[model samples]
Target: MTEGTSNDSTSDHLSNNGRSCCNKESTNSNILDAVQTSIDSLANKEWSNVESRVLVVYTGGTIGMVRNNRGALEPKPRDLERRLRGYPHMHDEDLAKEKYPNSPFLVLPLYKEKHCIIYMIHEYSPLLDSSNMTCDNWATIAKDIRSVYKMFDGFVVLQGTDTLAYTASALSFMLENLGKPVVITGSQIPIFETRSDGRDNFVGSIIMAG
Candidate 1:
């Protein structure tokens, strides 16, 4: 399960995966439904004239996992960006003409037609497994987001499912007076897999974060 927090209805941020095969057609429909629901929900809402930017704090998880020489899933630095870029649904080069070389963030442009979301992915170096998540790690994520609070319109936290609920709770408390969306999501299967839930999860987060 993934949880998100906002001033809107609590049900808006809930996402769960049941036991079933990954049907791409069904997945596409579900993704579109989620996007449509979000757009409809925002019909009466107000937004600024500036382009929407979301800060994605990816703190290591199965979503970014890649197979090693031994064919075992493991966290690999920089692999997430490569994988995401390979997916057409996740990256748009024209919208990301400007790049920050010194930053660890990958800017993504989603939904180019209208109501676009320009998000940045900040993947942690030397990724840590969910089992190693602790108070200190939580604090690090909080501080990182706080450090750039004024830059983005919303935020997303991607982590391993093993400790996703805990981090979500911790972040909810850590960010005081949070006016934007904060979504915490992860996948049970590696994103590189053909039947993985990561694609939808990532796209849905972008819609909410926008």
Candidate 2:
């Protein structure tokens, strides 16, 4: 009787262990299935339908500066837009002509996700150097963002590097309850230069804003 009891107990213990192993395998399979489903969903997703409209606030920064007659870097209105239009990475002329003939905005080339990024430049009148950025200027920037808050998905502020941080910090406090992204960036070297950091910085900022 004692031997029979021990044998039955051992059999029950083995049965429970087998069930636990099966349960673990089932759980792992479910997790893998879930992960694969998510991967397939993203892989099959249509990204072209998505578009990001970014408002570029050109606030007279080194990125947009050009040498004047005296060889001093000065902000030139509309020059930045012209230069961007010529840059293959920044603008697609064919795409602009095909889809956005009437629009003044530029289209970024289709990249990894094939999502379209349309950006319009709003240049500040008499752009000042970063050192000249004042409280009033910050207020104006905030108000400009507020006025078109609903129109665009995000905003990129291109300012001089001298006071870029200060302007960013000031805007943070001035623009209340802002839900959209606001990117402030500038390069030590002008974008017009052959070897300049502005290209990457501007492109990255636009992507981030989008």
Candidate 3:
């Protein structure tokens, strides 16, 4: 009687174990499928097959700032994209055009015959300023670049100069086997101003990144 009772208990435990394992596997599979669907939806755009692809990681800084209701400069989300799109000189559509009579082009300037920059920005939400940067912030920036390192020809880091020196130094060690250019720059003034260092820094970084 005692042996039978022990056996029954073991069997019941194993039965529950099997069910729990199956449930966990099903949950994992569903999560994976959802992730894949999201990735496919986001990356469905056709590529131009540009030789040079630069990834600009806009962490945040003075360059992307504007005066808020408090009358103080603060980083605005997505404002960098708006500013860049509006500034023809910063990203000249004419420059991106190939010499050929009919061809599609963007803002990037063609560097050699085939080394034109086709870049994308990955801006952080609630952009960080140089002063507020921490070790984790540096890690995030380094990891961001590492995640898509192979896909790009170069990288441009738009960050505040206040802590740029330390951040750059940290990245040098964190990023291993770097075979491409990684240009880090920030403007002393806001890009929205008519006469600002932002234009030069931005344009220069793009050219260098390409």
TM-score of each: 0.69, 0.73, 0.69
**Ranking, TM-score, top scorer first:** 2, 1, 3
The alpha-carbon deviation from the true structure for residue 73 of candidate 2, after best TM-score superposition, in angstroms, is 2.2
Cα lDDT of model 1 by residue, 72-187, tens digit = 98888866767776676687655444332222234455455665665556767657688778766776666565445556677788899988888877666565455677788899
Q: Relative to the unseen true structure, what is the C-alpha lDDT of residue 56 in candidate 1, on a scale of 0 to 100?
A: 73
Clashes of 1: 0
Question: Which scores better on lDDT, 2 or 3?
Answer: 2
**Model 3 ranges with Cα > 4 A deviation:** 1-48, 69-71, 93-106, 110-115
Instruction: Pick the TM-score winner.
Output: 2
- List per-candidate RMSD values in Å: 13.1, 21.9, 15.5
Per-residue lDDT tens digits of candidate 2, residues 1-210? Answer: 001122223333323333333233111123233323322333223223337878788878789888899999777886888888988889999987766655666888876667788777877777777897666676666656655555667889998888988887776655534557889999988887889999899999988888
The C-alpha stretches of model 1 lying farther than 4 A from their native spots are 1-50, 94-113
Q: At residue 172, what lDDT does model 3 achieve?
A: 60
Local accuracy of candidate 3 as per-residue lDDT tens digits, 1-210: 001122223333323333433233211123233323323433334233455666677889998788899878888897777667667766655554433113222356554665556566677766887998876676666556545555666778899989989877766655544566788889889888777998788777877776
Query: Which residue runs of candidate 2 sit more than 4 Å off their true CA positions?
Result: 1-50
